[model samples]
Target: MTAEKALLGCMMKENHLIGDTIIKAGHLADPRHQALFKQMRDRHQQGGTIDLVTLSTTVDLEPFGGISYLHDLQSFANVEKFAEYEELVLEKWKEREKRNILTVAKEEDWEIQKVIHALDQINEAKIDDHIAISTGLADLYEAPWQEENQIKGISTGMLRLDQMTNGFQDGELTVVAARPSMGKTDVMLHFAKQAGWNGDLPIIFSLEMPNKSLIQRLVASTGAINRLKLRNPYQHLTEAQKEQWPELIGRVSETNIQIFDGAGQTVAQMRAKVRKLMHEYPDKKPLVLIDYLTLIRPEHHYGGNAHMQVTEISKQLKGMAKEMNCPVLLLAQLNRAVEQRQNKRPMMSDIRESGSVEQDADVMIFLYRDAYYDQDADPKHLELIISKNRNGPIGTVFANYNQFTGGIRDAHD
Candidate 1:
């Protein structure tokens, strides 16, 4: 209370102090103080005066101890100690917010994940550190020299695509969109295989497929094993392939990959799970891979408004990427509008509920296979269209797609 009173007093005494501090009206403990601070801040923002004479006319000062309490507050005002009082008020506010969160959680019987997320929200809002433009300019000047011949981000395992994108970057959201059987999942698995092999952790959320199916695809991708042969090895596998099964399975098992095949996963649940993995594997950088977007359950239903739900989910996923300091590779399905087109190639607008997804994505790649629509076209030819690259150029990179094995790889490979 003392800190809040002193801070509000300083702001009222020096009207300019209201704009200098990040303190909000909610930071005040006393109801009257909250109301008074809000009025002062509002008036200052409007370019109006914030003195007692002005406030007394605009606001009912009776509840705020009339003009007498204003004098009492003014007595404690010290513009020189404004920063100290502002910090003290923020500290107390944070403490109160944390306690309130815990109390609400207990009363509502909220899940532990929800409680952690609420607490995290409080921490994220606690501080604002602004840096000068020159600091960023200095780093930008040195970046090219420092990263001259290296991949600046996690490798996508495709040489041409990697050359174009420099791989999926940290603090970014990369969306891979395609029609059914266009190898969207295969492309994600390709990235996961590369990330795992490079000593980075690939955390996969397979909302559409079971863990067993994903493992089969991974084994097929890593070992070049035929997918059908794995289904019924007794009939499809030859003696030579049968003898090689142990090594192929063992190779995939060695990579650091974690798969969650649960349905209706919310972003908060995924965040909590990822946080746990980060604590366990502090040394390994994690790449979060969600099989598809629409399947993700929103925290709150929007009366079946898919667009609103997707908007919320995409925003949260982008936030999660920056907060975790890692890349998030999200798979999405293209709408029927793509099939209606003459070219049948996907555009940003083809994404289902695309408004927010397109806006939130730092990178967007569309997968196209000519053979899917044309029987005479080359089945192995796949075009990875880089439709959007926020940090680099956008172009198409060709890759080999093996339908039999569910594998997507560099064309030259």
Candidate 2:
């Protein structure tokens, strides 16, 4: 209340302060203050004096105990600390806005993304937009010595991969790309399962596959059951495998994972789902997985051009990762041109639809299984090429992939 009064006083005292302070009608919490500031703003904009006499004639000051309240507001004004008072008023306004947003969110009419975006806009007034470089020097100097700061990320559960990439860091958009039938889904699911098993919440948006098929794969991988047998459980499973059903169910039930099997979902829908989940489980850290990016349909039609649509989606996903403070592991496909090349390994240029997919991803991983092309090649051998890692070294981690069991093991293992 005092800060609100002080802000109003500053506006009335020196009309020029209005532009300098950047105060708005919403910033003043008190209705009386808001009315007074509005009048002052109007007067200043119209080249009129914003003194008490002019304000008294223009606004209805009767409800605020007549002109005496305005006098008290003037007494509270301190020009030297005007900025500090403005900051306090803005902070209080933000808190009120947050409560209002949450209240509106409780109503069924409001979409979760709308509420989230509203909250984001309200908190966008950053206090430290400008800072001295020396202030960050200490943190940078100490970062190497601090173990916690060294790897500020969650584990993907692949040892060699984790060692090479330091897990998927927060605020990063990672793209895992592969040619068709090269085990991209299997490898990605394996990483998701690892993170889920470790209690890191994994939210999967499987645009291509249904939830049942995904669950069957999870059951096969976690329980070491054959994928085909797991698919036809009651009939195809052996007597021994049938006995492992309870444990397989238990293994799946214990993971902190949620799968959304929505085909052709737009970026907006995916963000809304993520925001909904985050609001529901506020405590857990979320890892968003979008299986094969190009399959996702754009919310707004981009003139029937697939490349433009995919590019927008990729950019939005990257921004969402930063805004949501989560790691987004998006699966993508290499262009069919990779298949024509003698070496089937994918390059950064091979990311389908748009080069922006590669440009936006903080880490770009390509899954290559030689056996997919060469029938006689070792089926178990796989390579995870970290072609572009913005925060770490780019390299390849060799691993063994069991096609039937859908299990991945480090090469040394």
Candidate 3:
């Protein structure tokens, strides 16, 4: 190890290990243990958003990134931290529970003490991404300064938005916004169908529509017919529209898009579902497509201003995108102010009360249709305006939306 790493390691071990530090900082030297500390490092790499039980799982190596150091390394018995002792004990019990100690011993037919040693080695000493961990995390955040992000490929999704932005980049909080009756839900259905069917990914958190309704739209979109038109016709339907349903159903049944349609959910519940998907699809980065932002409610314990609650929620979504290294397409609502404006085009300042919506976003696109204002509108165009982009030029891309088919296709210039 280099001189700096050696020093960091000693500080971590002495301050955290052998002592009863109430609060300490530094990453576990082992990369294998990094995943365990993600939530803590997420808030502030140096400190904050920490879990003692999670940190204790790793070897007491120096924590990395930001302005990290071991400032509070005294024993829990220290006069200053007497009350913290109770908390630490509770955390210690949880850590013990995590070992699956009883189950491991039974499986291996080994003694409890032997299993304990094995557990320590697996949880603490082992490296998650050994090679990467060995390097400083500061190295990770070196800003792509020395390099560029070369995404592997465009995702095989049906929606052209990924094509519009070249697949959601890592570390970005992308927001997709539109008004009611603007084909927002239909677009989401089409997006989910293409993404889930073409790739092996989890299409998470469908917050806007019912599961069955989303499915119907996907099937209808794929078939080139309006879901409502086919399900209920005024008099007689063309023979062609009636025939498209079977073909559409046959095509969509094969994709693996997952949905969470169990009533309204707290942000905590969404996190749990996303975590489950990440574990299940470790190879592919997770994609969370929340139908509409206003529908999301943070857990009850979350306090303070409502807008601030939404802001924190946005940051967390960005954090999730970064940690999972996946494209998150969260659908958001435009403030009624957009309706108040004569232009009706969205602006960053007008994404409701939560300015974080603008700040946290990596890419922001507004869905607009002139037809809503006037049915005589020709070309039936859907305008996708890139209000913000960290990478790529900002502009509008037009696509054709077949309301009758629930279909959105790239429009040729």
Each prediction's Cα lDDT score?
0.85, 0.80, 0.59
By summed lDDT, the worst window of 10 consecutive residues in model 2 runs over 120-129
By lDDT, the best candidate is 1
Q: Report model 2's TM-score to 2 decimal places.
A: 0.68
Q: Point out the worst 10-residue segment of candidate 3 by lDDT.
A: 17-26
Question: What does candidate 1's lDDT look like per residue over 1-413, in tens digits?
Answer: 88887888888888877865657777789999988987887888899988778877888998899988988888888877776687678678878998999999999999976876686565346343477999999868977668476647899988888888988898999999999999989889889988988999999999999999999898877767788777887898888877988998887877779999999998867876776677578899999999989999976565687887788889889988987789999999999998888999899999999759999999999999999999999999999999999999998999998988987777863
TM-score of every candidate relative to the true structure: 0.69, 0.68, 0.62
Model 3 alpha-carbon miss at residue 343, Å: 1.5
Off by over 4 Å in 1: 1-151
Report backbone clashes per prediction: 0, 0, 10
Which is better, 1 or 2, measured by lDDT? Answer: 1
Clashing pairs in 2: none
Per-residue lDDT tens digits for candidate 3, residues 1-413, read 12223323332333331122122222233342233234333433444323333345443535432223222221112432222332343344335544566676787799755754454343222223345564777667776677777674325242455555776666667787877777777666666666666565647576657787777677777876557764564444467755764665678876677888866675545655665565567666556778767677753223345675576568667766765566777887777888888998777766665647888888888888998887788636888888888776688877888877778887765
Give each prediction's root-mean-square deviation over alpha carbons.
Answer: 14.2, 13.8, 16.0
